[model samples]
Target: MRFDSVPMPTAVQARPRDSRGYPVPAITPWEGAEPQFALTDYGRSADCARGRLCSVCNELMPRGPVWRVVGGTESAAIAEALEAGRPYRNLAPTMEGPGHRACMLYASMVCPYLARPNARRGRTADGESELTSHLVRGTARGGRGAVVGFADYEFAITATQVLFRFLDVVEFLPHADADEHLGDLEAELARRQPR
Candidate 1:
């Protein structure tokens, strides 16, 4: 299927609102090599029940719930790992988790500009480049370190290895550019949808 002409639903453009209909602000996206705080902190800011916040511009996130794509036993395993409080990395290898694979694939597909090492140079938001200094090293307890990449916000392969976490809470500058990119994505998806 051709994924090149679907329209983004208007709902995707709906700004998150409080009871009063005012916009809520998200925490600013990370700005340096070493994280200003824990990874969970960033996760909380982006995903907390309070509301969707942009990690980059510190603005309210545009409304659209995460669209999870999981298949087969991998889906069940991720849920199980989350419930067990065991790290996901321990389970990823066993299932060859499709969710993990999908996340990486999606990242590579959607942000082709980021896949090239040299492409990332000088790509900064507020003086912070696209890359984060926090490298995923071997875990002290067990399992491998979760690798994370950022284009707008933090995207990480969770330690559990069961899920690929994408934290796209940043407001890209040149709003028109972002809208254009979204239009392109929507068009692509529509093209892929079966007739």
Candidate 2:
């Protein structure tokens, strides 16, 4: 995928790119000098949520209806609704923070594990993805992740994690297509429908 093709928000544009030219997410942890994509910097994450900052860019959001990439068991219903192109009411506390729609879109397309539906998250020798700031992360629970939007969110900070409760919800929409696979996915979806 051409990294330049990703529609970057202003803050995302300022981020340093990796060897492949993909912008490193603002909250990804740095181990020594390199980024460990598998880990989240909890301090920065909380700050982003608390300060109304974009999770992807780590800068203050300029608008409402924050978008987030939600996955795993908790996001099942929302994911299903999005795939079928319907709206959903979110009554659950969102565990992750807010991000710009464009930043989240860029991430969903550029991150291989996220872009490819069944791609496995690589693990290290000790059964973790990576260890620099290793937290006990769970594998994808057979559900494809979705980019959801919420007008506002309130923090539910605990000693271990930060969560968000979305207010004034919008469609909990999933990806129409991973940008890199647009052509193939469009054809594939069309093939499944009765003509």
Candidate 3:
């Protein structure tokens, strides 16, 4: 999908960008050294958890519907509902904190690793494959991502990632929908690519 055509959201634009102009996610650690996309900063993550900062841009989000990028298999609650032949109404816990919807959408459309199906999640200092936890490696099946929104969420801090217990279901954009948007975004980006 193309991404260059769409106007970047103000919050996304405020984020730090890479040399290639990709926004460096707020949760990504950067303390004067080169940014590591695979890692999350403890302090930064704590701030986001407690300060209501967007996980993608580090911007304060209004106390309302917030979005999270979920991986495969969903949560245990969803699984149980399906197992018991019951319809589920609420989203479960996610490993990451919520972010501004705009930043999440921009990320879903343009971030190479998050957008591309086969993109590497991370590389070690030697440029070798670096897959640590399920959080960094993304979905278990190595598939596309989905943006799930919640009206409010509960959180628990861990050393590796922040856990979010989603309260109310606001929006659920699965991989197929995201792909459609990506297609449109890519076409736009392609049109604007040649400057």
Rank all candidate structures by their TM-score, best first, as comma-separated numbers.
3, 2, 1
Candidate lDDT values, in order: 0.29, 0.62, 0.64
How do the residues 68-154 of candidate 1 rate in per-residue lDDT, one tens digit apiece?
A: 222223334444555676433322221111111122223223221222222222232222222223123221112111222222222
Full-model lDDT, candidate 1: 0.29
Q: What is the C-alpha lDDT profile of model 3 across 1-195, one tens digit per residue? A: 555554576666777777667678888887575677766676788889899999887888898989876544453444455568765554444446788776676777666555555655554321222222344443322454676677887887765556667765666565633555555434544564556
Model 2, 116-175: lDDT tens per residue? 555456542122222222223444324556666677778876675666676644745454
For model 1, what is the error of residue 129's alpha carbon versus the real structure, in angstroms, after optimal superposition? Answer: 16
- Weakest 10 consecutive residues, lDDT, candidate 2? 124-133
Count of clashing residue pairs in every prediction: 17, 0, 10
Q: Which ranges of candidate 3 are over 4 A from the true structure?
A: 2-6, 31-33, 75-94, 124-132, 135-141, 158-161, 177-179, 182-195
Better of 2 and 3 by TM-score: 3
Q: Which residue pairs clash in candidate 2?
A: none
Alpha carbon deviation, residue 148, candidate 3 (Å): 0.8
Cα misplacement distance, residue 153 of candidate 3 (Å): 1.2
